[model samples]
Target: MGSDCFDESFHGYGEFWCLGDTRPYMRALGAIANLAHRLGDVDKSIAASTEALRLCHGDNMGQRFVLSSLLLKAGRFSDALSFCQVWLDPQYDGLNRPRGGCEFNPPNPELLTARLVEWHSKPWSPGNLLLNAAYAAFGLWGDCELARQYLVLGTRANPNIFVKVLARREKPDGPYSRPRTTNGTDEAHDYRWLTQDLWAEPEAWVWINTNRDVIDIVVKTCAREGCGRREMRPLDFKKCGGCRQAFYCGPECQREDWQAHRQACRQANAPPAPPDSPVYAMSGFLNDEGALDAMTLDNSDDSSDLSDLWEYGVEVEPY
Candidate 1:
Protein backbone atom coordinates (compact mmCIF):
# COMPACT_ATOMS: atom_id res chain seq x y z
CA MET A 1 0.00 0.00 0.00
CA GLY A 2 1.15 3.55 -0.80
CA SER A 3 -0.05 7.15 -0.35
CA ASP A 4 -2.93 6.66 -2.74
CA CYS A 5 -4.22 3.67 -0.82
CA PHE A 6 -3.51 5.38 2.49
CA ASP A 7 -5.53 8.41 1.39
CA GLU A 8 -8.38 6.39 -0.10
CA SER A 9 -8.76 4.28 3.01
CA PHE A 10 -8.26 7.31 5.27
CA HIS A 11 -11.05 9.35 3.67
CA GLY A 12 -13.34 6.43 2.79
CA TYR A 13 -13.66 5.07 6.33
CA GLY A 14 -12.89 8.38 8.13
CA GLU A 15 -9.89 6.43 9.47
CA PHE A 16 -7.31 4.38 7.68
CA TRP A 17 -7.64 0.91 9.13
CA CYS A 18 -7.31 -2.77 8.20
CA LEU A 19 -10.10 -5.20 8.92
CA GLY A 20 -11.47 -2.89 11.66
CA ASP A 21 -7.95 -2.72 13.08
CA THR A 22 -5.28 -0.01 12.55
CA ARG A 23 -2.14 -1.74 13.76
CA PRO A 24 -1.21 -3.82 10.69
CA TYR A 25 -0.35 -0.90 8.41
CA MET A 26 1.18 1.12 11.22
CA ARG A 27 3.05 -1.98 12.39
CA ALA A 28 4.39 -2.63 8.92
CA LEU A 29 5.73 0.91 8.65
CA GLY A 30 7.13 0.70 12.16
CA ALA A 31 8.81 -2.60 11.30
CA ILE A 32 10.34 -0.98 8.24
CA ALA A 33 11.56 1.84 10.44
CA ASN A 34 13.00 -0.60 12.99
CA LEU A 35 14.77 -2.56 10.28
CA ALA A 36 16.19 0.64 8.79
CA HIS A 37 17.30 1.84 12.21
CA ARG A 38 18.97 -1.50 12.96
CA LEU A 39 20.87 -1.21 9.68
CA GLY A 40 22.05 2.33 10.67
CA ASP A 41 19.90 4.13 8.12
CA VAL A 42 18.71 6.96 10.35
CA ASP A 43 17.06 9.06 7.63
CA LYS A 44 15.13 6.13 6.17
CA SER A 45 14.01 5.04 9.65
CA ILE A 46 12.86 8.58 10.42
CA ALA A 47 10.85 8.78 7.20
CA ALA A 48 9.31 5.36 7.76
CA SER A 49 8.39 6.13 11.36
CA THR A 50 7.00 9.50 10.30
CA GLU A 51 4.77 7.76 7.75
CA ALA A 52 3.71 5.21 10.35
CA LEU A 53 2.59 8.05 12.65
CA ARG A 54 0.65 9.72 9.83
CA LEU A 55 -1.23 6.49 9.04
CA CYS A 56 -2.12 5.76 12.64
CA HIS A 57 -3.47 9.15 13.75
CA GLY A 58 -4.22 7.78 17.19
CA ASP A 59 -0.64 6.48 17.39
CA ASN A 60 -1.91 3.01 18.33
CA MET A 61 1.52 1.57 17.61
CA GLY A 62 3.39 4.39 19.41
CA GLN A 63 5.18 5.58 16.26
CA ARG A 64 6.01 8.92 17.92
CA PHE A 65 8.51 7.21 20.26
CA VAL A 66 10.40 5.71 17.33
CA LEU A 67 10.29 8.95 15.35
CA SER A 68 11.52 10.98 18.29
CA SER A 69 14.39 8.58 18.90
CA LEU A 70 15.46 8.72 15.25
CA LEU A 71 15.17 12.51 15.03
CA LEU A 72 17.41 12.95 18.05
CA LYS A 73 19.84 10.33 16.79
CA ALA A 74 20.11 12.20 13.49
CA GLY A 75 20.77 15.44 15.44
CA ARG A 76 17.67 17.11 14.08
CA PHE A 77 17.16 18.85 17.39
CA SER A 78 14.62 21.42 16.26
CA ASP A 79 12.66 18.81 14.34
CA ALA A 80 12.59 16.49 17.33
CA LEU A 81 11.21 19.14 19.67
CA SER A 82 8.77 20.41 17.05
CA PHE A 83 7.47 16.88 16.45
CA CYS A 84 7.14 16.30 20.19
CA GLN A 85 5.04 19.47 20.54
CA VAL A 86 2.24 18.06 18.35
CA TRP A 87 1.12 15.92 21.29
CA LEU A 88 1.94 18.34 24.10
CA ASP A 89 -1.19 20.51 23.87
CA PRO A 90 -3.56 19.34 21.17
CA GLN A 91 -6.09 22.05 21.89
CA TYR A 92 -3.56 24.86 21.63
CA ASP A 93 -2.02 23.50 18.44
CA GLY A 94 -5.37 22.72 16.75
CA LEU A 95 -4.27 19.07 16.74
CA ASN A 96 -7.03 16.47 16.53
CA ARG A 97 -6.73 14.16 19.51
CA PRO A 98 -7.75 10.85 17.93
CA ARG A 99 -7.85 8.99 21.22
CA GLY A 100 -11.38 10.35 21.78
CA GLY A 101 -12.43 8.68 18.50
CA CYS A 102 -12.01 11.86 16.49
CA GLU A 103 -11.61 11.81 12.70
CA PHE A 104 -8.15 11.07 11.38
CA ASN A 105 -5.77 14.05 11.02
CA PRO A 106 -2.08 13.97 10.20
CA PRO A 107 0.11 15.24 13.05
CA ASN A 108 2.47 17.53 11.07
CA PRO A 109 1.72 19.79 8.16
CA GLU A 110 3.43 19.26 4.78
CA LEU A 111 4.48 22.88 4.87
CA LEU A 112 5.65 23.18 8.46
CA THR A 113 4.34 26.24 10.32
CA ALA A 114 6.47 28.55 12.41
CA ARG A 115 3.64 29.56 14.74
CA LEU A 116 4.55 28.79 18.32
CA VAL A 117 2.08 27.09 20.65
CA GLU A 118 3.10 27.94 24.18
CA TRP A 119 -0.09 28.39 26.22
CA HIS A 120 0.27 24.84 27.57
CA SER A 121 3.75 23.38 27.12
CA LYS A 122 3.59 20.74 29.83
CA PRO A 123 4.29 17.34 28.26
CA TRP A 124 2.46 14.12 29.11
CA SER A 125 4.42 11.97 31.59
CA PRO A 126 6.98 9.57 30.16
CA GLY A 127 10.68 9.61 31.00
CA ASN A 128 11.78 9.14 27.40
CA LEU A 129 9.56 11.88 25.97
CA LEU A 130 10.79 14.29 28.61
CA LEU A 131 14.37 13.19 28.06
CA ASN A 132 14.12 13.60 24.29
CA ALA A 133 12.52 17.03 24.65
CA ALA A 134 15.28 17.99 27.07
CA TYR A 135 17.98 16.92 24.65
CA ALA A 136 16.39 18.83 21.80
CA ALA A 137 16.18 22.01 23.84
CA PHE A 138 19.76 21.77 24.99
CA GLY A 139 21.37 20.52 21.79
CA LEU A 140 21.79 23.43 19.36
CA TRP A 141 19.35 25.92 20.90
CA GLY A 142 21.49 25.88 24.06
CA ASP A 143 18.40 26.56 26.12
CA CYS A 144 19.50 25.07 29.41
CA GLU A 145 16.52 26.34 31.47
CA LEU A 146 14.01 24.60 29.22
CA ALA A 147 16.20 21.48 29.28
CA ARG A 148 16.37 21.63 33.08
CA GLN A 149 12.57 21.74 33.34
CA TYR A 150 12.32 18.66 31.12
CA LEU A 151 14.98 16.85 33.12
CA VAL A 152 13.12 17.63 36.35
CA LEU A 153 9.89 16.33 34.87
CA GLY A 154 11.63 13.16 33.68
CA THR A 155 13.16 12.62 37.11
CA ARG A 156 9.77 13.08 38.76
CA ALA A 157 8.09 10.61 36.43
CA ASN A 158 10.86 8.03 36.73
CA PRO A 159 13.34 8.46 39.56
CA ASN A 160 16.01 6.30 37.99
CA ILE A 161 16.22 8.03 34.57
CA PHE A 162 19.18 10.34 35.26
CA VAL A 163 21.27 7.71 36.97
CA LYS A 164 20.90 5.25 34.12
CA VAL A 165 21.21 7.90 31.40
CA LEU A 166 24.41 9.26 32.89
CA ALA A 167 25.96 5.87 33.52
CA ARG A 168 28.70 4.59 31.22
CA ARG A 169 27.47 1.67 29.12
CA GLU A 170 27.51 0.19 25.64
CA LYS A 171 24.60 1.63 23.68
CA PRO A 172 22.20 -0.83 22.12
CA ASP A 173 21.90 -0.41 18.35
CA GLY A 174 18.42 -1.84 17.80
CA PRO A 175 14.91 -1.10 19.04
CA TYR A 176 14.23 -1.91 22.67
CA SER A 177 12.96 -5.51 22.92
CA ARG A 178 11.43 -5.59 26.42
CA PRO A 179 7.96 -4.62 27.59
CA ARG A 180 7.89 -1.10 29.03
CA THR A 181 6.09 0.05 32.17
CA THR A 182 5.19 3.60 33.19
CA ASN A 183 7.85 5.19 35.40
CA GLY A 184 9.53 1.82 35.83
CA THR A 185 13.24 0.93 35.74
CA ASP A 186 12.64 -0.88 32.48
CA GLU A 187 11.43 2.35 30.88
CA ALA A 188 14.46 4.26 32.16
CA HIS A 189 16.86 1.57 30.97
CA ASP A 190 15.20 1.44 27.56
CA TYR A 191 15.62 5.19 27.01
CA ARG A 192 19.15 5.17 28.39
CA TRP A 193 20.19 2.22 26.29
CA LEU A 194 18.80 3.55 22.99
CA THR A 195 20.08 7.12 23.49
CA GLN A 196 23.40 6.35 25.08
CA ASP A 197 25.45 7.89 22.26
CA LEU A 198 23.59 11.19 22.40
CA TRP A 199 24.33 11.54 26.09
CA ALA A 200 27.86 10.25 25.68
CA GLU A 201 28.75 13.33 23.66
CA PRO A 202 30.92 15.63 25.76
CA GLU A 203 28.62 18.65 25.62
CA ALA A 204 25.46 16.68 26.49
CA TRP A 205 27.21 14.73 29.23
CA VAL A 206 28.56 17.90 30.84
CA TRP A 207 25.16 19.51 30.86
CA ILE A 208 23.58 16.44 32.44
CA ASN A 209 26.37 16.19 34.98
CA THR A 210 26.21 19.89 35.82
CA ASN A 211 22.47 19.87 36.43
CA ARG A 212 22.12 16.43 37.98
CA ASP A 213 21.58 17.84 41.47
CA VAL A 214 18.83 20.30 40.50
CA ILE A 215 15.67 19.00 42.20
CA ASP A 216 14.02 22.28 43.21
CA ILE A 217 11.98 22.38 40.05
CA VAL A 218 9.12 24.22 41.61
CA VAL A 219 10.33 27.79 41.03
CA LYS A 220 11.58 29.44 37.86
CA THR A 221 13.00 32.94 37.56
CA CYS A 222 12.20 35.72 35.13
CA ALA A 223 14.29 35.67 31.96
CA ARG A 224 15.23 39.34 32.21
CA GLU A 225 18.87 39.99 32.98
CA GLY A 226 18.33 41.89 36.23
CA CYS A 227 14.95 40.64 37.33
CA GLY A 228 15.31 38.18 40.20
CA ARG A 229 11.64 37.34 40.75
CA ARG A 230 10.70 33.65 40.64
CA GLU A 231 7.34 31.94 40.27
CA MET A 232 6.28 28.47 41.29
CA ARG A 233 3.63 28.25 38.60
CA PRO A 234 3.99 29.16 34.90
CA LEU A 235 0.63 30.95 35.01
CA ASP A 236 2.27 33.70 37.03
CA PHE A 237 4.92 34.36 34.36
CA LYS A 238 4.29 35.65 30.86
CA LYS A 239 6.05 33.62 28.13
CA CYS A 240 7.69 35.17 25.12
CA GLY A 241 5.29 34.75 22.21
CA GLY A 242 8.18 34.19 19.79
CA CYS A 243 10.45 31.52 21.29
CA ARG A 244 8.06 30.27 24.01
CA GLN A 245 11.09 29.56 26.14
CA ALA A 246 11.65 32.90 27.82
CA PHE A 247 9.39 33.75 30.75
CA TYR A 248 9.01 37.26 32.11
CA CYS A 249 7.70 38.66 35.36
CA GLY A 250 5.76 41.23 33.32
CA PRO A 251 5.76 43.31 30.12
CA GLU A 252 8.44 45.66 31.44
CA CYS A 253 10.93 42.82 31.75
CA GLN A 254 10.03 41.46 28.32
CA ARG A 255 10.42 44.86 26.63
CA GLU A 256 13.76 45.40 28.31
CA ASP A 257 15.11 42.00 27.32
CA TRP A 258 14.06 42.09 23.66
CA GLN A 259 17.31 43.40 22.18
CA ALA A 260 19.42 40.91 24.11
CA HIS A 261 17.19 37.91 23.34
CA ARG A 262 16.03 38.69 19.79
CA GLN A 263 18.53 36.59 17.85
CA ALA A 264 18.19 33.42 19.92
CA CYS A 265 14.41 33.81 20.01
CA ARG A 266 14.17 34.01 16.22
CA GLN A 267 16.53 31.04 15.81
CA ALA A 268 14.53 28.94 18.24
CA ASN A 269 11.17 29.63 16.60
CA ALA A 270 12.19 29.40 12.92
CA PRO A 271 10.62 26.66 10.84
CA PRO A 272 13.05 23.89 10.07
CA ALA A 273 14.26 23.11 6.51
CA PRO A 274 12.79 20.01 4.87
CA PRO A 275 14.29 16.69 5.87
CA ASP A 276 17.42 15.59 4.02
CA SER A 277 17.27 12.76 1.50
CA PRO A 278 17.24 9.30 3.06
CA VAL A 279 20.77 7.88 3.35
CA TYR A 280 19.68 4.53 1.90
CA ALA A 281 16.76 3.14 -0.08
CA MET A 282 14.73 0.26 1.39
CA SER A 283 11.95 -0.06 -1.19
CA GLY A 284 13.27 -3.48 -2.21
CA PHE A 285 13.18 -4.76 1.35
CA LEU A 286 9.74 -3.26 2.00
CA ASN A 287 8.44 -4.85 -1.18
CA ASP A 288 9.63 -8.26 -0.11
CA GLU A 289 6.48 -9.81 1.37
CA GLY A 290 8.32 -12.41 3.35
CA ALA A 291 10.66 -9.85 4.90
CA LEU A 292 7.81 -7.45 5.74
CA ASP A 293 5.77 -10.27 7.32
CA ALA A 294 8.69 -11.49 9.37
CA MET A 295 9.59 -8.02 10.63
CA THR A 296 5.98 -7.19 11.57
CA LEU A 297 5.61 -10.56 13.28
CA ASP A 298 8.68 -9.92 15.41
CA ASN A 299 7.41 -6.45 16.47
CA SER A 300 4.59 -7.92 18.58
CA ASP A 301 6.71 -7.78 21.72
CA ASP A 302 8.07 -4.28 21.06
CA SER A 303 6.11 -1.66 23.05
CA SER A 304 7.04 1.89 24.01
CA ASP A 305 6.64 3.50 27.43
CA LEU A 306 4.32 6.23 26.12
CA SER A 307 2.12 3.67 24.36
CA ASP A 308 1.97 1.36 27.38
CA LEU A 309 1.49 4.11 29.99
CA TRP A 310 -2.31 4.00 29.90
CA GLU A 311 -2.36 0.22 29.83
CA TYR A 312 -0.11 0.21 32.90
CA GLY A 313 -2.87 2.15 34.69
CA VAL A 314 -0.92 5.22 35.72
CA GLU A 315 -2.19 8.78 35.92
CA VAL A 316 0.17 11.12 34.07
CA GLU A 317 0.75 14.26 36.12
CA PRO A 318 1.90 17.53 34.57
CA TYR A 319 5.05 19.10 35.96
Candidate 2:
Protein backbone atom coordinates (compact mmCIF):
# COMPACT_ATOMS: atom_id res chain seq x y z
CA MET A 1 0.00 0.00 0.00
CA GLY A 2 2.83 2.41 0.92
CA SER A 3 4.77 1.55 -2.27
CA ASP A 4 1.64 1.94 -4.38
CA CYS A 5 0.85 5.38 -2.90
CA PHE A 6 4.40 6.66 -3.58
CA ASP A 7 4.85 8.69 -6.75
CA GLU A 8 7.53 7.08 -8.93
CA SER A 9 7.96 10.29 -10.97
CA PHE A 10 9.29 12.27 -8.03
CA HIS A 11 13.06 11.74 -7.87
CA GLY A 12 13.65 13.37 -4.44
CA TYR A 13 13.21 9.95 -2.78
CA GLY A 14 14.87 6.52 -2.98
CA GLU A 15 18.11 5.30 -1.37
CA PHE A 16 19.90 4.23 -4.56
CA TRP A 17 18.72 6.96 -6.97
CA CYS A 18 20.95 9.80 -5.62
CA LEU A 19 17.74 11.82 -5.14
CA GLY A 20 16.84 11.64 -8.86
CA ASP A 21 19.02 14.63 -9.71
CA THR A 22 18.17 14.86 -13.37
CA ARG A 23 18.19 18.04 -15.49
CA PRO A 24 14.43 18.53 -15.08
CA TYR A 25 14.62 18.18 -11.32
CA MET A 26 17.39 20.76 -11.13
CA ARG A 27 15.46 23.15 -13.39
CA ALA A 28 12.35 22.78 -11.27
CA LEU A 29 14.36 23.53 -8.13
CA GLY A 30 15.89 26.57 -9.84
CA ALA A 31 12.42 27.82 -10.78
CA ILE A 32 11.23 27.41 -7.21
CA ALA A 33 14.19 29.46 -6.03
CA ASN A 34 13.38 32.20 -8.50
CA LEU A 35 9.75 32.22 -7.39
CA ALA A 36 10.80 32.42 -3.77
CA HIS A 37 13.01 35.40 -4.60
CA ARG A 38 10.13 37.15 -6.39
CA LEU A 39 7.95 36.55 -3.35
CA GLY A 40 10.53 38.40 -1.17
CA ASP A 41 11.47 35.37 0.91
CA VAL A 42 15.20 35.94 0.44
CA ASP A 43 16.46 33.33 2.92
CA LYS A 44 14.19 30.67 1.46
CA SER A 45 15.31 31.61 -2.01
CA ILE A 46 18.98 31.34 -1.03
CA ALA A 47 18.40 27.89 0.44
CA ALA A 48 16.71 26.72 -2.72
CA SER A 49 19.46 28.12 -4.93
CA THR A 50 22.23 26.66 -2.75
CA GLU A 51 20.63 23.22 -2.86
CA ALA A 52 20.40 23.41 -6.65
CA LEU A 53 24.09 24.32 -6.87
CA ARG A 54 25.02 21.40 -4.58
CA LEU A 55 22.87 18.91 -6.51
CA CYS A 56 24.27 19.97 -9.85
CA HIS A 57 27.87 20.60 -8.76
CA GLY A 58 29.08 22.04 -12.06
CA ASP A 59 26.22 24.62 -12.03
CA ASN A 60 25.43 24.00 -15.71
CA MET A 61 22.21 25.96 -15.37
CA GLY A 62 24.07 29.06 -14.14
CA GLN A 63 22.51 28.72 -10.69
CA ARG A 64 25.75 30.00 -9.15
CA PHE A 65 25.10 33.46 -10.57
CA VAL A 66 21.63 33.56 -9.03
CA LEU A 67 22.96 32.12 -5.78
CA SER A 68 25.66 34.79 -5.64
CA SER A 69 23.14 37.61 -5.94
CA LEU A 70 20.76 35.93 -3.49
CA LEU A 71 23.56 35.58 -0.96
CA LEU A 72 24.18 39.33 -1.05
CA LYS A 73 20.46 39.99 -0.84
CA ALA A 74 20.20 37.76 2.25
CA GLY A 75 23.14 39.62 3.91
CA ARG A 76 25.44 36.62 3.61
CA PHE A 77 28.26 38.82 2.40
CA SER A 78 31.23 36.61 3.37
CA ASP A 79 29.53 33.55 1.94
CA ALA A 80 28.92 35.41 -1.29
CA LEU A 81 32.58 36.46 -1.57
CA SER A 82 33.88 32.99 -0.68
CA PHE A 83 31.45 31.39 -3.10
CA CYS A 84 32.64 33.70 -5.87
CA GLN A 85 36.29 32.90 -5.13
CA VAL A 86 35.79 29.15 -5.25
CA TRP A 87 33.61 29.06 -8.35
CA LEU A 88 34.80 31.92 -10.61
CA ASP A 89 38.45 30.98 -11.16
CA PRO A 90 39.86 28.02 -13.09
CA GLN A 91 40.82 25.04 -10.92
CA TYR A 92 43.49 22.71 -12.23
CA ASP A 93 43.73 19.12 -11.07
CA GLY A 94 47.46 18.81 -11.62
CA LEU A 95 48.01 15.33 -10.18
CA ASN A 96 45.38 13.44 -12.21
CA ARG A 97 44.53 15.50 -15.30
CA PRO A 98 46.90 16.67 -18.05
CA ARG A 99 45.23 20.08 -18.41
CA GLY A 100 42.45 20.85 -15.88
CA GLY A 101 38.91 19.88 -15.01
CA CYS A 102 35.82 21.84 -16.02
CA GLU A 103 34.02 21.33 -12.63
CA PHE A 104 36.22 24.21 -11.42
CA ASN A 105 35.85 25.04 -7.72
CA PRO A 106 35.17 21.82 -5.85
CA PRO A 107 37.29 20.00 -8.47
CA ASN A 108 35.07 17.55 -10.32
CA PRO A 109 37.43 16.37 -13.09
CA GLU A 110 34.79 14.24 -14.82
CA LEU A 111 32.84 17.31 -15.92
CA LEU A 112 32.91 18.25 -19.63
CA THR A 113 35.59 20.48 -21.18
CA ALA A 114 32.82 22.60 -22.73
CA ARG A 115 31.93 23.73 -19.20
CA LEU A 116 35.31 25.47 -18.91
CA VAL A 117 35.54 29.11 -19.97
CA GLU A 118 38.68 31.09 -20.61
CA TRP A 119 39.59 33.10 -17.51
CA HIS A 120 40.21 36.73 -18.32
CA SER A 121 43.79 37.92 -17.72
CA LYS A 122 42.52 40.25 -15.03
CA PRO A 123 41.23 38.11 -12.17
CA TRP A 124 38.10 40.18 -11.64
CA SER A 125 37.05 40.47 -15.30
CA PRO A 126 34.04 38.14 -15.33
CA GLY A 127 30.98 40.39 -15.38
CA ASN A 128 28.70 40.13 -12.31
CA LEU A 129 30.74 37.61 -10.36
CA LEU A 130 33.59 39.96 -9.49
CA LEU A 131 31.27 42.93 -9.17
CA ASN A 132 29.27 41.06 -6.56
CA ALA A 133 32.55 39.92 -5.08
CA ALA A 134 33.58 43.55 -4.61
CA TYR A 135 30.28 44.45 -3.02
CA ALA A 136 30.41 41.42 -0.79
CA ALA A 137 33.98 42.20 0.23
CA PHE A 138 32.99 45.69 1.29
CA GLY A 139 29.86 44.50 3.05
CA LEU A 140 31.78 41.87 5.01
CA TRP A 141 34.99 43.73 5.88
CA GLY A 142 34.40 47.44 5.24
CA ASP A 143 37.77 47.46 3.54
CA CYS A 144 37.44 49.98 0.76
CA GLU A 145 40.86 49.22 -0.73
CA LEU A 146 40.21 45.51 -1.30
CA ALA A 147 36.73 46.24 -2.56
CA ARG A 148 38.15 48.77 -5.01
CA GLN A 149 40.39 46.11 -6.55
CA TYR A 150 37.42 43.85 -7.16
CA LEU A 151 35.43 46.79 -8.53
CA VAL A 152 38.16 47.60 -11.03
CA LEU A 153 38.37 44.03 -12.29
CA GLY A 154 34.60 43.71 -12.49
CA THR A 155 34.39 46.88 -14.57
CA ARG A 156 37.02 45.55 -16.97
CA ALA A 157 35.00 42.39 -17.51
CA ASN A 158 31.91 44.37 -18.41
CA PRO A 159 32.68 47.97 -19.31
CA ASN A 160 29.02 48.95 -19.31
CA ILE A 161 28.36 47.53 -15.82
CA PHE A 162 29.11 50.68 -13.77
CA VAL A 163 27.62 53.41 -15.96
CA LYS A 164 24.55 51.46 -17.06
CA VAL A 165 23.64 50.13 -13.63
CA LEU A 166 25.19 52.00 -10.69
CA ALA A 167 25.56 55.52 -12.10
CA ARG A 168 22.02 56.09 -13.36
CA ARG A 169 19.30 57.48 -11.09
CA GLU A 170 16.47 55.58 -12.83
CA LYS A 171 16.06 51.83 -12.91
CA PRO A 172 17.05 50.31 -16.24
CA ASP A 173 13.95 49.76 -18.43
CA GLY A 174 13.59 46.36 -19.90
CA PRO A 175 11.03 44.07 -21.41
CA TYR A 176 14.45 42.43 -21.74
CA SER A 177 12.98 40.77 -24.87
CA ARG A 178 16.15 41.22 -26.84
CA PRO A 179 18.88 38.65 -26.31
CA ARG A 180 21.67 39.97 -24.06
CA THR A 181 25.15 40.37 -25.46
CA THR A 182 28.17 39.38 -23.35
CA ASN A 183 29.34 42.46 -21.40
CA GLY A 184 27.09 44.74 -23.48
CA THR A 185 24.43 47.31 -22.52
CA ASP A 186 21.67 44.72 -22.56
CA GLU A 187 23.57 42.52 -20.13
CA ALA A 188 24.09 45.50 -17.84
CA HIS A 189 20.35 46.27 -17.96
CA ASP A 190 19.45 42.72 -17.04
CA TYR A 191 21.95 42.70 -14.16
CA ARG A 192 20.60 45.98 -12.87
CA TRP A 193 17.05 44.74 -13.19
CA LEU A 194 17.80 41.66 -11.12
CA THR A 195 19.84 43.16 -8.27
CA GLN A 196 18.71 46.79 -8.16
CA ASP A 197 17.58 46.79 -4.54
CA LEU A 198 20.80 45.29 -3.19
CA TRP A 199 22.77 48.34 -4.31
CA ALA A 200 20.30 50.87 -2.89
CA GLU A 201 21.37 50.72 0.75
CA PRO A 202 22.90 54.02 1.91
CA GLU A 203 26.32 52.58 2.80
CA ALA A 204 26.48 50.39 -0.30
CA TRP A 205 25.35 53.24 -2.56
CA VAL A 206 27.94 55.62 -1.07
CA TRP A 207 30.71 53.04 -1.49
CA ILE A 208 29.79 52.58 -5.12
CA ASN A 209 29.73 56.33 -5.78
CA THR A 210 32.98 57.01 -3.94
CA ASN A 211 34.92 54.22 -5.62
CA ARG A 212 33.46 54.64 -9.09
CA ASP A 213 36.11 57.19 -9.96
CA VAL A 214 38.92 54.61 -9.55
CA ILE A 215 37.71 52.72 -12.61
CA ASP A 216 38.39 55.73 -14.81
CA ILE A 217 41.68 56.80 -13.19
CA VAL A 218 44.64 55.29 -15.03
CA VAL A 219 47.89 54.99 -12.99
CA LYS A 220 50.84 55.08 -15.42
CA THR A 221 53.65 55.16 -12.83
CA CYS A 222 56.45 52.61 -12.73
CA ALA A 223 55.34 49.57 -10.70
CA ARG A 224 58.87 48.93 -9.45
CA GLU A 225 59.56 48.61 -5.70
CA GLY A 226 61.26 51.99 -5.11
CA CYS A 227 61.03 54.04 -8.30
CA GLY A 228 57.61 55.68 -8.84
CA ARG A 229 57.90 57.92 -11.86
CA ARG A 230 54.71 59.01 -13.62
CA GLU A 231 54.78 59.68 -17.36
CA MET A 232 53.61 63.08 -18.63
CA ARG A 233 51.35 61.28 -21.08
CA PRO A 234 50.12 57.75 -21.76
CA LEU A 235 52.23 55.21 -23.70
CA ASP A 236 55.47 56.57 -22.20
CA PHE A 237 55.65 53.63 -19.80
CA LYS A 238 55.94 50.04 -21.02
CA LYS A 239 53.62 47.49 -19.40
CA CYS A 240 54.97 44.12 -18.43
CA GLY A 241 53.81 41.44 -20.88
CA GLY A 242 53.59 38.77 -18.18
CA CYS A 243 50.72 40.19 -16.10
CA ARG A 244 50.05 43.41 -18.11
CA GLN A 245 49.01 45.06 -14.85
CA ALA A 246 52.49 46.25 -13.88
CA PHE A 247 54.16 49.14 -15.74
CA TYR A 248 57.87 50.07 -15.87
CA CYS A 249 59.58 53.26 -17.03
CA GLY A 250 62.38 51.33 -18.74
CA PRO A 251 64.07 47.95 -18.97
CA GLU A 252 66.49 48.82 -16.16
CA CYS A 253 63.66 49.53 -13.72
CA GLN A 254 61.85 46.41 -14.98
CA ARG A 255 64.96 44.29 -14.34
CA GLU A 256 65.39 45.82 -10.86
CA ASP A 257 61.73 45.10 -10.00
CA TRP A 258 61.74 41.48 -11.23
CA GLN A 259 62.73 40.07 -7.85
CA ALA A 260 59.80 41.73 -6.08
CA HIS A 261 57.31 41.04 -8.87
CA ARG A 262 58.31 37.42 -9.70
CA GLN A 263 55.99 35.58 -7.33
CA ALA A 264 52.98 37.81 -7.99
CA CYS A 265 53.59 37.67 -11.76
CA ARG A 266 53.65 33.87 -11.73
CA GLN A 267 50.47 33.82 -9.66
CA ALA A 268 48.75 36.25 -12.07
CA ASN A 269 49.65 34.23 -15.18
CA ALA A 270 48.94 30.76 -13.75
CA PRO A 271 45.97 29.25 -11.97
CA PRO A 272 46.02 29.94 -8.23
CA ALA A 273 46.94 27.15 -5.87
CA PRO A 274 44.02 25.25 -4.41
CA PRO A 275 42.81 26.45 -1.03
CA ASP A 276 43.71 23.09 0.51
CA SER A 277 47.10 23.01 -1.18
CA PRO A 278 50.27 22.83 0.95
CA VAL A 279 51.49 26.06 -0.64
CA TYR A 280 49.15 28.15 1.50
CA ALA A 281 49.80 26.07 4.62
CA MET A 282 53.57 26.12 4.17
CA SER A 283 53.80 29.83 3.34
CA GLY A 284 54.37 30.81 6.95
CA PHE A 285 56.93 28.12 7.54
CA LEU A 286 58.89 28.99 4.37
CA ASN A 287 58.96 32.79 4.44
CA ASP A 288 60.43 35.05 7.09
CA GLU A 289 58.07 36.65 9.59
CA GLY A 290 56.34 39.68 8.04
CA ALA A 291 58.19 38.99 4.78
CA LEU A 292 55.03 38.43 2.75
CA ASP A 293 53.44 41.59 4.17
CA ALA A 294 56.48 43.66 3.19
CA MET A 295 55.69 43.45 -0.54
CA THR A 296 54.01 46.85 -0.89
CA LEU A 297 53.34 49.15 -3.84
CA ASP A 298 55.97 51.51 -2.54
CA ASN A 299 58.51 50.15 -0.04
CA SER A 300 61.00 52.89 -0.79
CA ASP A 301 62.27 55.36 1.84
CA ASP A 302 62.05 58.26 -0.62
CA SER A 303 59.34 60.60 -2.03
CA SER A 304 58.22 57.68 -4.24
CA ASP A 305 55.68 56.83 -1.53
CA LEU A 306 53.84 60.08 -2.21
CA SER A 307 53.80 59.43 -5.94
CA ASP A 308 52.56 55.81 -5.68
CA LEU A 309 49.29 56.72 -4.05
CA TRP A 310 46.51 54.16 -3.69
CA GLU A 311 43.29 55.03 -5.44
CA TYR A 312 41.02 54.45 -2.47
CA GLY A 313 42.39 56.10 0.70
CA VAL A 314 44.47 59.10 -0.28
CA GLU A 315 42.97 62.58 0.07
CA VAL A 316 43.40 65.37 -2.49
CA GLU A 317 43.79 69.15 -1.91
CA PRO A 318 42.02 71.85 -3.91
CA TYR A 319 44.10 74.05 -6.24
Instruction: Report the error of model 1 at residue 206, Å.
Output: 0.2
TM-score of 1: 0.54
Worst 10 residues of 1 by lDDT: 292-301
Per-residue alpha-carbon lDDT of candidate 2 for residues 43-106, written as tens digits (9 for 90 to 100): 8888777666554444544566677788788787777776776655566221211111112233
lDDT of 2: 0.54
lDDT of 1 by residue, 219-299 (tens): 348888889987643235546665555767777777777778777777765664333422121111112121221111011
For every model shown, what is its TM-score relative to the native structure?
A: 0.54, 0.51
Off by over 4 Å in 2: 1-21, 92-124, 172-179, 212-319
- Candidate 1 ranges beyond 4 A from true positions: 1-4, 12-14, 17-22, 90-124, 212-319
